[model samples]
Target: MSEDAIQAAARALSAGRLVILPTETVYGLAADAGNPEAVAAIFEAKGRPRFNPLIAHVATAAAAERLAVFDDAARALAQAFWPGPLTIVAPARADGGVCDLARAGLDSVAVRVPGHPVARAVLAAFAGPVVAPSANRSGRPSPTTFADALEETGPSAAAALDGGPCDVGVESTVVSVLDGRIALLRPGAVTRDQIEALVGPLPADQDGAGEGHRSPGRLTLHYAPEAPVRINAQGASDGEILLGFGPGVGDPRWTLSATGDLREAATNLFRLLREADREHPVGIAVSPVPMLELGEAINDRLRRAAGFVG
Candidate 1:
């Protein structure tokens, strides 16, 4: 990590200017969470809807507690999953600096302690909550690499830091620990099984219209590419590029994983989506990925990208 780059990003955030910061999952369009005008700049820059909230990144679990009211279950989850790709949504503290615009006018705030050293350093240097959404335009694929992220949001950003290609390559798994209950809000690198092992079984995804205020990724047609997408495709159609999974799929250039590894597939998901669009295929066909564990997050992204979420 370049100390100068980290300090520059932190200074940008402190001055209420938009900056791009890298995380394990994706690069983010970051702003000072306590500054409404700064947070509003993010909404304007991305053309993101006001209804969709943003996730506030903190330096540590202790920093997270200052923003949200956590119960025992929430604490347990945080102790086990913090410093990683998991966002805990809970009641907001009256003095928590996250502004109303950043919270999408909800009483709850979506907060996380990122594991990426760059993000962590910026948070500590900025010494406050920062709201960071994917560094891309609304309804587009999240950028996993610095070049792609800068291309999408660089013109709007005042400063940018490259933490290299994101290893996780998907957004954080969002779970609401509000009111002493744990409910799945959105799937990402962290799977449901991992959470269940720590805090007992979690219910199905609670990211519906009624519960949308509490999560950032509840949109119906998010992570979309310019070209239309076809899901569960065993093979490609005419003028379509196949993003394959298992063996015999043939197109290694676009293959997520020939050996059927879910982790590799997840890491490559958004990158391939971006590349396939660049190829200007009439449509993009996707190989069937099993809906289990990490696959749940992969399928969720594919469904939204295809604009056919249920």
Candidate 2:
């Protein structure tokens, strides 16, 4: 949060070292997108597969334009949602300078202009594209606070910026605008309705695993905890930690939202999972979250956390 800290992180990044920077969604393990070795360190630190592409965080729309060819829909979405949690995937410009490793050697790149001031400041200070994925080991819950990030991957990073907890508490909604069509890649705080309002109805969700990796967050069994997770439970059995949604679950350890506000539940989702996993319970059972608005994103994360697929 300090100017000195930002400067130090900028310097480290300029020197091709990793820095854990906070975003509105989650803390990210950031490296120079143009530096292959620096970007490689992120994979090494998180144990992430090379085929999973990274999101390139930029300072402005112009910066993003420099990296990818924006179509009509992509431009409009960027104008409306840049500086927020909406990632746009577009064809990488032939001259786009992002490293091959960061893009997974694909012709497209997932890029965003984050809303978090600390993250924006770091991007501006570094003055280039930063490939930052969630700052946690692969298949683990993402860190929403500085303390959790430190516990997760701090030793591998040169420095970490403490910017408090993330406001969104989930990854950005990723939409790929390719070949004159818009496809929802991932859901987040930005609802499908919002994107549809601007770009018309979206095509079916893109299968990154089947088609190829054009964006991040496509792994089947990701964002998981050490404890087995069971979703849509009416109640938790003995020895299991209950994560309730609409309350009335009889003194649950963590309630996503006692009032049943999906937004509030989304904000608390990852932090609660991290907390519950720390207890080393027999298992974690969660109440059903409505399949609407932010709930879609919350459930997406929960499903992945439970390792239901892949």
Candidate 3:
């Protein structure tokens, strides 16, 4: 990481400007969590709704504790998965300086310590919590590379830190540890089985799905592409692009993983989606991915991308 780049990003963030920072999962459209105006810029830049909250990325577990009151379970999960892709949603500290706009005016706040070195350096340099959603336009595929991030959010941001491609290539696994019970809000690279081993069986749907937004990625139509999407497809329609997995019938425009490696497929998911969508196809058809491990996260994104309700 360049010191000049880090300093420039820190300066922009301190000046209440947006910065595109990379994480282990995906690049984020970052803003100072304590600044309401900065947080509002994120919403306006992405055309995102106010009801959807953003994840506050901190430098360390101690930093996260300052923003949210963690219970024993929350602490265990944090200790086991901090500086990683696990986002813990806990009760917000009443005195915590996170602005209401960043949390969508919710009593609870979603916090995480990113594992990316560049992100950590920027956070440490900024010396404050930074709330960042995926560095893309609202309802668009999350950018996995800094180049892609710059292409998506650059014009709207003050600067972007290039950290290459995201390793995990998916959002963090979000769990709400509030209300004394562990609820799985959104599945990502951190498998439910891994979380369950630590916190016991999680509730089926603990996320409050009503009016108020408890966490990000809860929106019905999100992570969408420009073209219409169709899932569980064995092949593509006449003018559609087929995004295939494993073996397939006709020639696919792109393949998530020809070898059927879920991890490889996960890494390629957004990149391939963005590629296929660039063609301006009539629609994008996706082959069925097994509902296991990283596949769950893939399917979750696919379902939302296709605008499926249930």
Candidate 4:
């Protein structure tokens, strides 16, 4: 991407306007984290619930430390996973620049140091924290390509930066470390094994409708496609569009990973869903994916897309 595009986007955020930004995970509708009006624009544009909160993206982990108070575990995870698909949720500093709306009126904040070159360039140029939620309309499939992003909510943005297709097709893995304990809030490109290896065992996160304010990806019916979805599907039901895993699992055009690679499957998940939804099929069916490694993150998105998450 050109420096001009990045600078234009940076300027828009500085002016409390919206910008559509590319990240390693997916396209995001970004705003200045310190600007409540800009942050409110994101909710209005995406039709996202105010209580869902948003993640503050920074250029570096050191920059992130200025806003969120990270304990030992949070710091270790940040060191190991920053510049990649991992978000650390922790206690907010008294002077953290993130606005109350971005934190959903909570005392905690979710922050990520994205790995995408274009996103990093914009963050560095902006020289401040910005909150970026998925660019698509709330509860819709996330946009993996610039075209899809523009189609979803581009009109609401003052500027946009295209970084081609996202390397990690899913959002960041989110973990919260508070009061000397750790819990997994959301699963994404970062696998559990990778985090557990660095931070030891993690406990299950306890949350309900009232607690949705603590995280963005906790809702059960998020990431939905236009058509209904059936998981562990043996084959496409009559008129159903099939998305299968592994070689020869189903039509090659709809396959997640022809070689059975979980990483490839994760990268293709959202794109396939978007493609299938366009065909106006009776429904979407997905073959059973093993709950291993990146599979957990893949299944997490699938379950949410199918409205089975809780």
User: What are the lDDT scores of the predictions, listed in order?
Assistant: 0.90, 0.89, 0.89, 0.89
Write down the worst ten-residue block by lDDT for model 2.
Answer: 203-212
Candidate 1 lDDT over 1-310, as tens digits, reads: 8788889889888888999999999999999999999999999989999989999999988989999998998888899888999999999999998999999889999999999999999999999999999999989999999999998989989999989999999999998876667788889888999988888877765553356468886678889889999999978889999999998784899999999999999999999999999999999999999988999999999998988765
- Give the poorly placed runs of model 2, Cα more than 4 Å off: 208-212, 250-252
Q: Name the Cα RMSD for model 1.
A: 1.2
Candidate 3 per-residue C-alpha lDDT over 49-116 given as tens digits, one digit per residue, 9 for 90 to 100: 99888899999999999999999999999999989999998999988879998888899999999999
Model 3 steric clash total: 0
TM-score of candidate 4 to 2 decimals: 0.97
> How well does each candidate superpose onto the true structure, as a TM-score?
0.98, 0.97, 0.96, 0.97
For candidate 2, report its TM-score. Answer: 0.97
Q: Please count the clashing residue pairs in each candidate, in the order shown.
A: 0, 0, 0, 0
Q: Which candidate wins on lDDT?
A: 1
Q: Write the per-residue lDDT of candidate 2 for residues 64-138, one digit (tens) a residue.
A: 999999988899999999899999999998777789999998999989999999999999999999998999999
- Runs in model 1 lying further than 4 Å from the true structure: 208-210
RMSD of each: 1.2, 1.5, 1.6, 1.6
Better of 1 and 2 by lDDT: 1
Q: How accurate is candidate 1 locally (lDDT)?
A: 0.90
How does candidate 3 fare on TM-score?
0.96
